[model samples]
Target: MHLIHRPDIVASEITPPDVYLDRRRFIGQAAAGAAVLAAGGLLDPRAARAATAPREKLIGVKKSAWTVPEALTPYQDVTTYNNYYEFGTDKADPSENAHTLKTRPWTVRIEGECAKPATFAIEDILKIAPLEERVYRMRCVEAWSMVIPWVGYPLSELLKKVEPTGSAKFVEFSTLADPQTMPGVRGRVLQWPYVEGLRIDEAMHPLTLLTLGVYGEVLPNQNGAPVRLVVPWKYGFKSAKSIVRIRLVDKMPVSAWNRAQPSEYGFFSNVNPEVDHPRWSQAKERRIGEFRKRDTLMFNGYADQVASLYSGMDLRKWF
Candidate 1:
């Protein structure tokens, strides 16, 4: 991603002001050559900036059938249209309001049912698994979509290192909640410290990605910078952003949306055209930056890789 000095930067030249942070962060991190993006299916954490990254970091990254050759969604649309309720309910609120968030000096609190339950700085987290780029389709529960190129390593690599106990049935993740930095947190929109959870097998699936960045740049402040979860097959909301903690447990964990309105949002929010939302049909979705509606695919077209994970389970009931 190209860096610019001011918020009034031309949309054609660099990321928008609200999406991009101050120039000092770019210059300082760039000079150090440590700012790198990670992939999977989540937003990246800028606080987890890399001061030093391997030159050939992308060498191991590979393209899968899941990747479509579609041109990427414009940087402007992707940054402006968002649903980070922590920032605001409107799509543009995050871009317009998330500038004050400080990503540096970040720490991930890892706990619950793991052999290694220790806090990890962003740098140390990236070290556990080599970074790789994955271009995946992001299907939101609202039936909107985008194709974002994310950079990060497989979550399995880290989970393996942490070693979950046999009794662990689910994994829970929480986003940062700093009212001082994020203006929207002060409102009772959904819940403070947005939380999302995944079943143990789902979390361990090879397709699950711990996103560190988007479009090959350290995630912009509005895009859940620092760290987020990115599960391609599930609705975008399942990929919680600005993560601060993770936990392993035996019971199904409650998520923000599901907790607020379980009838509308289910814990196993896998993308399925057949299963319509209570208010709308899920058979089709609006791709961001495009006018035409596209037929929704089951598991966002990742059925081949993750279909078996829910083999005999009743998707409708679980959803």
Candidate 2:
């Protein structure tokens, strides 16, 4: 029942859900959408052309309350133009080299201030909540964007199931550390085992999704396969991928990027154009597959929905 949002836009402006929710219009638009699916294609030197995960398998998944009324970035673009540093720092490194990384035989250890501290099988994680599709606009810190059809469930579902203790004020996520397959592990690019965190309330927000797949298919290794977090209102880096640990604690957890350069990257990380990156203007973003740049939005356009979450705090200070 909860709706998802971008940082600067109102919920109603998201894909015309009202039209789709209507029985007659839904059928008409769906038919129209199907016909237009094949013509558009884009190639990025930063990406690759490869077979995508089975999007057909997701036909049955329920749609989330919101979507972006726009064409998706080419699947090849989403899979290859990735920021997953585990494989390498280059944009195409993930797609080209992540196959060597194993995803099966995975387990996520949940600990810290919770009634239940347990380790769950990767498959079991999928069973915790029913998966659904949310077509969201992903705005990265680098000023580029993509519209991704992510399949997952609200993060609140898992937090509730685990029963976070009252003392738990923040949630920290830790990514896998497989030096054997992840070549980037050898370099000092980032502290190994990348870590990110969210304030407890932020983690519990309805828009915070724990992603398992994309475009209806199980996740590709380069796309944070198996497991990751998708926080639509924040910059993409806040959504830690290939997670292995979820810990609840009273204090805010230090994230990799923020720790490395505290002055540039803040813990809140809400996408706000008013607050420019150290070296560039964030007022406009270059969406992948597009020739023209569009103005960036506050909270990446979800300000109306999520701004209240930080009501008393200064976004400029926190960001």
Top candidate (TM-score): 2
Q: lDDT tens string, model 2, 156-263?
A: 888787889999999999999789999998888989789999999999988899999898888888889789999988999999999999999999999999998899
Off by over 4 Å in 1: 1-66
- My TM-score estimates for the predictions, one after another, are 0.80, 0.83
Q: For residues 81-200, what per-residue lDDT tens digits would candidate 1 score against the true structure?
A: 888888889887787677777888898887899888878898787677766678889999898999988877777787777788888899999899999987788988878789999999
How much does candidate 1 score in TM-score? 0.80
Q: Compared to the true structure, candidate 2 yields what TM-score?
A: 0.83
lDDT of 2: 0.86
Stretches of candidate 2 above 4 Å error? 1-60
